[model samples]
Target chain A: MEVAEKTWGLMKKKVLVIEDNADHQAIIKSSLVSRNYLVVCADNPSDALHYLLDEKIDLIILDLWLPEMDGLSFLKDLKNVPEFSEIPVIVTSGTFGSEYDILKLNGYGVREFFMKPYDPAELVETVGSLLKKTVD
Target chain B: MFYYTDPKRGRDMKRQKRVFLIGLLAAILGYLWELYLIHSHPPFIFVKIKPTWWMQWVILFAAWRIGVFISGLWKTQPTASSQKENDREEELKYLSRIYQDLSNSLRLEKGKFEAVLRGAPDGIFTLDEVGRINFWNESMEKLTELKKEDVLGKPYEDVLTFYSTGKLVGFEQGTMEGSSSSEPRQAVNFFSFNGDQSLSFLEIDAEVSGGKEFPAAVSVSTLKSPDKKNTEQIIITVKDMTAQKEIEKLREEMIAMITHDLRSPLSSILGYAGLLQNPKLCVSEEDRQKFLTALIRSGKGMLLLINNLLETARLGDGKVPVISEPVKIKMVLEEVAENLLALAKGKNLSLSVEAKDNLWADSDKDKLHEILTNLVSNAIKFSRSGEAVKITAFEKAQEVVISISDSGPGIRAEEKEYLFEKFSKIKKQGSTTGLGLYIVKKLTDKINGRIVVESQEAIGSTFTLKLPASKKASSSVQLSLVGSR
Candidate 1:
């Protein structure tokens, strides 16, 4: 799952990936960080909440399943805190079905939903496009 | 001369016969007396027939005296003393009837007792207070392979001698291990009886015909007299418990097999998953594919093993229940919170819950309960002294989020590779089967929800689940007070 479309614009984009699986987290970080996009990681949402406060996070990548709190609920909880609502969350999960559509998640204030064993390239491209829009 | 028989017929016949003889004598007496009177002193003057006539007079006088005795006897009735004699005989008959009834019931009871003992399926025998084998049942005869005639009425230990480890069963030489079982360890030894635990071996008259030994559960009980007045006998019942012992052995064998089989596959999956998750390893695409394929295969194998060890239904049935009802999410969380508080307190941990007043989730109550319970229990398992575990839930836009946070030795970032994988071990987790998290994940997937983990080393960990909130229960639905009841 590597991205063929690598960005040439050398701007440091800071992102926090709230994920529990180390391998998937490693794969996501490796695929994104190599392209000059700095990734901050938290194993759960509560820690994700910390990085949101401490850093200038451009975007957030959240795993749907986590130990401390689920991604959607954390999204909902994060939305209640006015400042975190401005941050767009890219939800990634190992689970799928009709109930897990990206549009359906958008209704929960999620910007995107990625199914795992996901293509790391597509994720990077999607992150690039969203970050570009926010920067503009 | 006639006998006066008991019946009145014999007495009348004898009386009539004697009267007829008397009548004949009277006629002769009338004529003879006239002649004798003429001879003695003539009616007008002395008419002498001679001195021989004197003998005739003596015979006549003797007949008259016997007749007077018979007449007197005919006038008397049965005496009062004789009536008393009849009454005495009636009393004797009534006494005999009562004696018959008492003796008959006693005999019947004795017959029943003997029959029960004789027909018993298990070996049974009775010993007198002195330990003499007075009674032996049919089963005992069959068990010993000796006829009742041979063993009964003889000293039990001598007649039906059995040796276990070359020591007598009832009279063990010195309570040796291999010898006959020890005497009752309970208070029964204080009395003459042996408690049911005193088991022994009974070999057929092994001296005469060598026979295999069968273990017998022996119960020696004191038999009371029929009136329950006194104890004079001891009865022993022996049941062959060989089948029960065999079943117990089989169960131990099954447990051994489960441990050996389940552990190997678990470690196999853990090792393979660990290897596959390494991102920096330089390898050919084919090799990576091979390892990935092996990892999946081994992972399935581990799942099959665990599925067999525990209930296999949890995986299959978990996905099928779409029972979408507006369940009060706070009620379940509160119930789980109250229940696990004691467990947390046992380790000096504080467990608390925070939830909105009437938040509801569109989900199956049972599945959600299982999911919540597994998460909460896992929290307590990894927690230690003075750690506080918190459960918080709230409805966020279109979904309700529940979180169980535990101040425990949290997972390392590296080991998180397979945190929720089936049979994966967590840091500092002692020997648990590790099926809890895997099941929890599956249940979350089934309910169309998702779980997330947040942890830091030495800080703590929290597991949160986001389930869709039921629109029908929008707001203002009050869940009944659920905890501290």
Candidate 2:
């Protein structure tokens, strides 16, 4: 375990957050950064896609509602790509809480779903566990 | 056994008894006359025939009695032909009464049916089996602007036309059974008149008189005979769907907007609060202050949205009482400016108030303050950084004119009309609930004030409020100024 921890320390896991709300973006970034994880913020899906093209994102935190293209469509497009399909995704929504939406997200291989006003501590814990499983 | 006696039969019996008594008396008199003739004549032939002649008199009496009895029987009994005539007369009378009752009830039922049709809210009409308009109600007359007399006995297709997807729908007799090869089956598929009592509702655009069209929901039910083989009549009810459709659309949009607006602020508040509560994370003093400020701001925004929603509901009832008093305009402006100073500073915008000393207006103090606060905050929210939001007040004739001007993106010409409408936001910027201007307009109207807008696109916009001035205060000020002069 000590050796594993050392190896984890050698390589930091990178997470991408796609959120339109500036305040939410700042809060999520601060929480993840405090946990020794690298965080990249994008205000929209297009910018998030640009980040994905430029970096190897290990995990993703997505907001369902967006300005240009909705998060579901972006997720679909991402899953179609061979490289990004394996990356774990955590979905967050402020307004969408229907069972149908959750089922669709589950079908798209989402690792976690969180409603707005969710605990940041829990989110950080989940992200850490998901990254650890990937490393193992 | 009970026996029944007729008065006419009793009269004939008494007459028959009197005839028999008379015949007996005549027989006795004839026998005496025969004896006297035999005694007086004393001839040989008369003596021999005396007894026999008396017998002949008796026979004559018997014959007379028999004839009277036969005549009495004939007078008492009725003949077959006369009895048949009497029975026919009674049957005719009974049939006439039944006919009278049936016609009366039918007339009453018709009257009731007509009254119900006329009182109905939806346009109701009935068509004959041949698709001619047989009955049109008052509502139908109002809906189509055509009188009953004009439409009665006319083909329904000629008067009313329906369209679906911009294609004309044909409505002919028996079209519900499916259309022919020459007709478009899709157009007539909406109708389901299978001689059943079931009703089918269809949404279509109905063209009225003068080629005016509106969305309508039409329901049709067929009346069939007992055998259900033929449709006797078709009852159609039309309801105008234009208002209902618009309301449904508005309700959907309102729900979406309200959910987005409410959750946005709530997310921010929760996020900031969560950050502040984290024990392990090292939050700098300045960062802590910023986080706390954001929390407060989000809380205030949520409260304002809730209050605006409640205010809209209250104002819908039109029961906001106005307490008119002499309110100092300058003091109101200063208070509004003080309240919105933080908001303006956040955006690096300056708020300035220009009002003469003791400038007074006769209005509701609380309402006036609320109006000014909303207008000033809106100006601050729209204005760019380093720009100025100016509030000026002056007296024009007997009215006080107050204008709030902002160096922001001015509204376009077409957009100005819907500036103060509920849920109408010209530009979706920041986290505005779009109820601010609507509340402002309602508050202004409640105080009997008029609002006007002056704007040039890409420059700035000014909202001017004209209110009645304080008469007594102005008169006193005029007197004091004259005395000083």
Flag regions of model 2 displaced more than 4 Å.
Answer: A1-20, A36-62, A65-90, A104-111, A126-136, B1-246, B383-388, B407-415, B425-427, B454-461, B471-485
Worst 10 residues of 1 chain B by lDDT: B183-192
**For every model in order, what is the iRMS?**
9.8, 2.1
lDDT of 2 at B191: 34
TM-scores for chain B, in order?
0.37, 0.61
lDDT of 1 by residue, B83-123 (tens): 68757866997899989998999899999988988999988
Any runs in candidate 1 off by more than 4 Å, and if so which?
A1-136, B1-88, B159-191, B194-210, B224-231, B270-299, B302-485
TM-score for candidate 1, residues paired by index: 0.31
Fraction of the reference Cα-Cα interface contacts (below 8 Å) that each candidate reproduces: 0.00, 0.49
